[model samples]
Target: MKRIHGYVLLRESNQGIPNLLVCAFDAEGAVQDLLGARRGAERPTLTFGKLGKRIGSVLTGTDGAFELTRDDLHFEGVESRPDLVLAVLAPEDVVDPRRPVALPPEQRILYISAVPRSEAGAEEAYVIRLQQAQLDAFGIALDTSADNAHKRIAATQALLGDVEAGTQIRAQVAGRLHGRLKTQHRREVEFRDQAKKAVQLVALPHGLRAHPLLLSEASKLPDLQKKALTEGIRHLKDAHRPQLRISLRAAELRTAGMKLDRRGKPIGKINTLKLADVLRNMLGGVSLVRKDEVEPSALSDIALRARSATRTRARGAVDRAGEEGQGKALAREPGRTTAKAVKSATPRRDRRK
Candidate 1:
């Protein structure tokens, strides 16, 4: 039944080293809701979210001051705000020093630590730790063969076994890893396909069907059309691996069609025209640009259309004005008097004769 909550504070260092800090509040303490738009104050019983368990957790002291060391530090990627979660740990969940059952969550502790552990392989341990934490916190179970097995395999699969057991265990672990990979791959493909169909495409290239428009990246593209092209390519390519052929950048972004008048004023709107959608365009074929290339300003599809329309209107006006001038000159020619005036002049001349 014990619980705690807190806000994460961002501490920046000039040297670019990763350090983490969490300002945990009492179980019923008052704090602003960082996750909300209104950010109203709430006193939730469990604020330290589930991920709090894996992150830097420091024990509280008698003086109400929780000290943290470099060992308790690790950086998580960007968060809307620093927030903690609640842990309803049973008394038996006492193995972790961070969650000592003897001390309640009211101490309002801060967690920090130094990560001296080096990465074992290609991926950094910290990144994996963060991803694992996320998966553990909000993971769903699958009723696959792995769960149906009656074998009570624990410790990430057979840790202690006979002399020949090492090879067998390694093979078992490899099989499990392969199974996990296949499941992940299947889910990723399904999700990507769904995303592609859901979004109204503003621009799509032929070759790179796997990659879709990244709205987060596109919104940052420059506003001018000339610049939107060059800069959009640079930003898009930078987001992925150097070798990844991002055939289209802003071009793939979804845009809202802004219906505009001849004066460049918005006469109507297309709902999808977000900032990023306008900076890119889709052509008959995909545009290719390397990460080392140029940058451009942002412009919307509506704006481009409006600009074109305005130019067309101006040209038509000039043509109409010339036709009207010629018509006026013909009406003002010398023998062009009205019928009544001509009759009056002839009658006076006939009477005198």
Candidate 2:
């Protein structure tokens, strides 16, 4: 069995903390927790109370170097191969406060994977490197389809064959594309619904139902409320796209200084960002541009309408105040019908008779 080594370095000058958690999914798809907390530094192995299982300790150095020194956690072994490897870096563990968004422990996990050739629509395999900044700025998620490329090609080829048999290719392509977009849109709506459920909503005294709140506004809440939002986003991501198997930019993956495998596919080390990160940034006020305009327009319009309504109410209050003040001044003027004068001038003959 080949021994595998993993290294985690803090390259930024004043960015992240040394504390981290490295987790993996075994061949059987069970999540195996690899401990990296400071409490278990001296101990050779730490035991989990719930699982009753012991695993090797992952240690960190004083200079912000985190390494899995033991070869016991090999990725090449028959039974030890991992389907995915992820690193969890919590908000507290991150030293930089300059970032626009901060994610909770569960949502902060960065997926590290080598995208296969078939998935990339290429003859050779490549690794994609994603960072926190890219995810924060663009709000783009990693495509996590296993064989989406092949499926698309097969569909297109069948359409071409139909064209040769006298069918209109352009119309067929348009129909297929429209169907795919509708499915994608539906999934996006479902994901947002799940995310909103994670937020804590407060009930209003004036109404029977809870107060209406946007996910972006609810995400600004403190403590447990914020945690719930992040967890909800992660759950949605896990269900929709579990693996980061999307095609990436070729310019980002360099050919030079890369080690090739027996089949000539480049196997290189790359950093990663997650789709969950995109959600975090979006809720944190980062503007996201998507291929479909309706999706982003729906969210931005909600916030816009809320702000507009607030301004309208403020203007109405000011106008009412001014009108009341003018009316009181007019009543105080000479010859005006004051409350006492009006009552005194009223007919008293009926009462006297």
User: What is the lDDT of every predicted structure here?
Assistant: 0.41, 0.46
| Highest lDDT scorer | 2
TM-score against truth, every candidate: 0.14, 0.19
**Which candidate tops TM-score?**
2
Q: Write the per-residue lDDT of candidate 2 for residues 1-353, one digit (tens) a residue.
A: 22323444323322222344444222222233333343355321322232222223343333234444236444343333233333333223333578745545344444333221111111111122335563443243323242355456768999888878565666678788998989999999998889779974555454644443323454466755777878889888785745655333343333222355788576776543433343345458555557754556557877879979999999999999999999988778676676787778878985477
Lowest lDDT sum, 10 consecutive residues, model 1, at 9-18
- Report the CA-based lDDT of candidate 1 relative to the real structure: 0.41
**After TM-score superposition, what is the CA distance of residue 140 in candidate 1 from its true location, in Å?**
38
Clashes by residue pair, model 2: none
